[model samples]
Target: MMANTNGYLVGSNLERVLKAGHFAVTAELGPPQSAEGDVIRKKAGLLRGYCDAVNLTDNQTAIVRLSSIAAGAILVQEGLEPIIQMTCRDRNRLAIQSDLLGAAALGIRNLLCLTGDHQTFGNHPSAKNVFDIDSLQMVQMVTAMRDERTFQCGDSFKGPEPRFFVGAAAAPFADPVDFRPLRLAKKAKAGANFIQTQLVYDIPAFEKFMAKVRALGVHKQTYILAGVGPLKSPAMAKYMKSNVPGILVPDELIERMELAGAPWAGKSKEELTKDDKKARSAAWQAEGIQICIELINKLHQIEGVSGVHIMAIEWEDAVRPIVEGAGLSPRPVVTESPPLAAALG
Candidate 1:
């Protein structure tokens, strides 16, 4: 792995930009359910100039989607940097290591290791759970592959090993919030160079989490990118709050969405026209974007936060507006080598 002048190992522009002391911006790309390279290319194009890197989720929420690594290869072809997400839900240790080798062979340099959601919540609820190695072990294994050129069983590699900018996820709002920071510390000790946290709606709670993180000194060991996004409507907000584990959407945000949709408040469900509903929905989405912008502005002021991860979900078009509104437009240029192909060779 090549180290920049500052001695930070940076394989992609995302790492370069962050290590260069810039407030980095990253977004998520949800690969379509079908095997369509055009869909990946289109989404990549939308995020190309706006973000430092884009994270391609691996079967996010346990829903079956196009493969993250395949979609990442498509993004690389589109001249975009992709952070490929690897979850331990569907694969065992052998498959995981094999995929990592394949991804590196394809020129992928950034990886986000995850302990996937339980299969019971996904479309394949009947499928067996494969906790072959938890995410902590996954992080340690990848670190060993990159730094030691050895497999988890202590076997040496015959050829060049994969060099990745490793990352993991954290949920600051999860139950037993006090344990969240300690959990992050464990991942960092296990070799997570960076972390992208779950969606952060309650800033006060997030501040508390960061305080504990700083106290534990985990912030010094890893770069943290707080997650932010725009909710499409009041229903979307409520759905996420009630159904999504570890996500806390404050009532104030939901109330704000209600106010935005109040223009059509008195209309009966059957009486409301499609156009009226569209306008109301647009109002709520606009408010959502505003809230996201505010959050980004505040997140930058937090001492340990290195950047923001804007997860627009399927609403890719909303990313540009949020980024620009947050004054993160005109992203910095990091003169790094091309991703995957150049990096691997």
Candidate 2:
């Protein structure tokens, strides 16, 4: 593990890459439901070098999975940096801080604080939740831990404190549309160093949102990484557009996905053979990747966007082509700098 001698918070690779002004790329790595380190290692192989760092989701969707910190440690061993996600759904402040210390001890330096999805949506629908603190408070808690070397209760650490490059989520098109920007401002005010947004398919809407963001000057306070992903099928696209909260998939993109299946457009399920369905699936995926590449290009032109977060979800292989197609391959490597105090001297 590298020492905290760099003139940056935590000195994580993600922070350095963004500080260097590179349009950074980050991807999601969903840990398996079982206790298999090999699953994480295999996913790391797919993302290594294609992104600055990969986010290990913390029991995403409130389902049980290999712990994010544990999966992150595996990523660290694989020579890939990890952004460990900490959710407020399952743990209280004490558990959160303890796990954070464990993560930092294991060489993980990036943290994404999230108010996780409700437990009713997951397999454990009857499970009790522990929302001791929301994401905003979680951000403030970690920030205090890193900056002031104090616990959430304001108690000073007896030993070296955990340092992190803290992150929070943003949803541009969520409900109360007019207030999304203000919600983001609150996160920035709470001390988020970076913001990874919800999936953005409605470019025009996102542009309008950024207009407000820039007006409030939140972008200048923290780095914003636009989230993107490849649609597996037209059904998948439609489902997200109609069902998912905070995600707005444009009608044109859904139409594009539908058009990709033009060959079997009117065919009934019984009429379509296995091979026909398979072929159509491939075509839709190809179009999806192309669409993602185009979105990345457009996002690059958006003024406040610092980079992109590709949420390829379960389809890790799509990241390579999507990144390469967008001409963001061969990611930059930024060397470490002296600590802040030493640099000041």
Candidate 3:
């Protein structure tokens, strides 16, 4: 893989970027399957000046998606940081190992290891399943690469081994309270450096999740970023309810959307490009932003919590206002790139 193409030194290296006391924002954008690289590129360009880093989702929700690495290369070329999302459902250890090395060789630093959605959830329901390993093991793999400078299973490296600022995902609102903390800790123990959680709707539930995170001391050990998505319309709300797992929309939010005045229930909420006012009026969009910032401002003051990752699906353009409105400044500390990091092993 080629490296040092642009200013995006390492997308996986945000672990190094995050300061203990400061709040940060990493936005995500999903790629379209068709020849729509421009769509993602244009959005990334718009967000270049706002988000600390932009995440390219990999086949989000088991649907066919454009290659995140390729799309990420485009972002990096445009002088923006790109966080590469890697899912285990699509590749095995060999493929993952090679890809990690290739990514680092290409100077891509950030990596989010996920045990992607089941094949049944995607467009192709008949495709074969590959649970060859899970997200927990994937953490161990990256951790081993970092600490031991070798493959996760103990293979020696012919050249300099790869190291990734590895991240993992969790849904505090997903399951029972009894097992959620344990599962999150397991990934950390297995070697996840950062935790980017599943979408959170209920702030109390998130606070409860934080309590568990604080109780276990993992909050101190890992960088936890609260994930958020703005409800575009009641139709979008309905989609989340029927499709997304581990996400809960508050009755109040739903009520507000359904009970919203004419403009919200119409196409304005969905089509008003770069118009924050439209989303703010009679919709759950502003509520989502305020909720995220309120929680973020609180998270900033929390003893162990670090930052927040805003997943503004198609609303990347609105991130700056939301963040600036919250009074969190975007301070990107410039670090020089290490001499060309790409040399195939």
Candidate 4:
């Protein structure tokens, strides 16, 4: 099989675009908590043509939502490329491998592997955890299936195997921050072709993390897309800082949100009509978008950085403006091809 410039035997348009040296763009969309396909389609429509690919999150925050693979298949049917996220929180290796085969069968070509948030964070706090394999092992298992044509048990497949452009996540701002880069290096060595980091707000800290990554030469081995998003409100910022693990929201950003909402900050619920509160909230969101755009511009210049992954996080409508604002609109046209398994067959 002929490999693309990025050196993967099987590559999607995303891989080809990145391999051809375009600044790749990806976005995330959480499937609706309900089983309504229309909701998923609606959100997916908002992202189409705005990004190279859209990520269908896998039970993000451990909340029950439409299955990622199922949602991805819907997006595929809508003529959009979907990166089906798979988390190990709910499934063992058996289910993981089974779903990978099914996802590829449905024409889903990209995947983002993650060790999902603990169930305690979800609506189902009493649910049992089934982390049969960590995210690193998940990467290795999928790589084996794709590149080695073998199952996790080392059993060779008698037929076609799933071909995926595998990805993993990195948290640059996580505790024991100094060790973060090394964790990334381990994932790269384990066969992760690309990485999308956790939400990044503190650039200086991210730059330091990238410095260590470059020093180790892992950047050369895998493409790194810094994660970024728009903060909806000052309360949202505070909640994330206090509740979400590994997220770093600078106090200056919180102050900016407060200032944006200052007009109505002093007003009581009775004094401020719904419109007044809506207008003030919009201000905070607007400032948040601006900050996100600035971060994208800065991250582009960082060495070893390949692209930005915009995670609007329920703010799907904001994606178009953010991408256009950052001058990333009119995404490059890249040719797509059949999966490696089918093409080779």
Candidate 5:
């Protein structure tokens, strides 16, 4: 597959796109919280020239996104490979199927299928949650459409179905560990080509999850990505601890952060008036960073997990440094021929 004028490979679909390997890194370019095109375009361009691909989040955080497809089109204009994420919360099967075809026709093939957060989780509390299907089902639907050229309603191919590298989410730290292995297997069985895991903090738990997959012996069959992020502030830590699902913020870590921040959290704004420096650098580098680096190494060392997809969210701008710091090099960009003129009579 060759790059478009902006440099993103124009024809590279899912399968070839991920094979560049080496801790396959992807960063999210969330749609604007409003209809602001300039803001979204800026975020898209910020990460445009780097990373394996950019994920345009769909109504992420249940807030209104500029629509993943629209953002993706803009990213394509900017020359970034865009992964158009689709959620089941707002759309039903017909809509989901319709969007898949639309996305492909628009030159976006990478897909991240999410069951979406419930509507109550967002600012618009009155919005309805449409759980028409779970994440795995959505993956299955995409698989059928791509591979069999058919829809859930048994529609036959009028022409060709778009090829997609279908991805699903796995919350390693989310509620009920029993569900982890089961869901992973179901998603794999349902034809999920890859998985982007939830944010991971406890390396031991993360390792155990891998071990469980190993015991199941299907480790080599799926692409597993380890999600990592740095705590922005103590306030952010508190919010994650109380609100986020399937996420456990160890009390000790919080206490350590508090101690690191010392009087900062409690300090009056006046006290820091003269010093605008951060209260403290959250020690994400201490052992924790190494632990993730080790996990990346192990995932590489192991047979089942093909690669890791780093999700820094807004902090994604720091991803290249982390990947390099972890000793992985940037993937060589693919070359493309200049656009050809149409055949004449």
Candidate 6:
């Protein structure tokens, strides 16, 4: 158990890093669809020193995968801190609280609460959805569990409580965009210590959103980590721009990705050989990484932006270069706090 010598709420490394005022870096790691611990270890190896903490996604995109808490425990053994993502899409308050206790017991200190993707979006479209409590409510419930040592049902914990560094997601470009800031305020008011936003591509639009966030004074209350991802190819960029909700990719970036494949520009897909396609894919990925690095650098300059959450999806290897390119490598070293019992002694 890590103790908080500096009066941090949870004494997690992430809390210490952010409070120390160092520009923080966090990356996402999706658990494999199978129950393999080595898979988590492999991904952890790639991301170990590149970021402050790695987020273990909970059934991302509604696709079934290794449980976030289980993978987080694996990461704990690998000497890398994990932020277990908890979604309200599948569990009720009881299951949610129980899982929180289990996660904390296993030394998982940070948590990212989410509303989760709709079941209809996943492979199991026939599965019944559970929205017993929304993400905002989840935040509030977890805060109470930590601060008050009480369960959501008003039951008191007899012993140690789950003291977590709570987090929540933010979508600056979500529909009713004007209401985004107000929604963020609700989460902050509910006690989310940090906020990782949806992928940001349009800098100007994000700037406007931040201006609103600063005006509302939400930035002062919580650390904001802008979400950024590498576009795999021009088609990928176009798909995100046209299909993904709450993600706003600028046209300039799409054109940039298109330009990356210029060497094969005149050749149609049918005319290109395997090697040609492979070369073009490599070029596009390289350009994507460069673009991501640029976004991180620019996002760091924003007043309220505390860090960048790099989501490379299955391309975990890109994190190293992206972090290095953004001048955020050699992540800050904040010592873990002492255990509660040791601190009391």
> How badly does each model clash, as a count of residue pairs?
1, 0, 6, 0, 5, 2
TM-score of every prediction relative to native: 0.94, 0.96, 0.83, 0.94, 0.83, 0.96
> Candidate 5 lDDT (Cα, whole model)?
0.68
Q: Give the per-residue lDDT of model 6 (tens digit) for 1-345.
A: 333436668777888888777799999999999988899999999998999999999999999999999999999999999999999999999999999999999999999999999989999999998999999999999999988888999998987889999999999999999999999999999999999999999999999999999999998889999999999999999999899999888899999999999999999879999999999999999999999999988899999999999999999999999999988878988775544432310
Worst 10 residues of 1 by lDDT: 336-345
Cα RMSD, each candidate: 3.9, 2.7, 6.2, 3.7, 6.6, 3.6
In model 2, the clashing pairs are: none
Cα lDDT of model 2 overall? 0.93
Order the candidates by TM-score, highest first — what do you get?
2, 6, 1, 4, 3, 5
Which portions of model 2 miss their true places by more than 4 Å? 1-3, 336-345
lDDT of 5 by residue, 94-130 (tens): 9999888888888887888998877787888798788
lDDT against the true structure, each candidate: 0.88, 0.93, 0.71, 0.88, 0.68, 0.92
User: Candidate 6 — worst ten consecutive residues by lDDT sum?
Assistant: 336-345
Residues 19-125, candidate 2: write the lDDT tens digits.
Answer: 77789999999999999899899989999899999999999998999999999999999999999999999999999999999999999999999999999999999
lDDT of 3: 0.71
- Residue pairs clashing, model 4: none
| Candidate 1 deviant stretches above 4 angstroms | 1-10, 336-345
lDDT of 4 by residue, 171-243 (tens): 9988888899999999999999889999988888889899999999998888899999988999999999888
Residue 245 error, candidate 5, Å: 1.1
Better of 5 and 6 by lDDT: 6
| Residues 1-345 of candidate 3: C-alpha lDDT, one tens digit per residue | 323324332233354356323466788988887767798778887677677777888888888888888777778788777788988888888888888888767766777889888888889989886777888888888767865777867887767767567789887877676788889888788777778888776777778778887899887667788886666666676778767778877777666566653453455546655565545453556655665666566656555556678888778766776678667656455454423332100
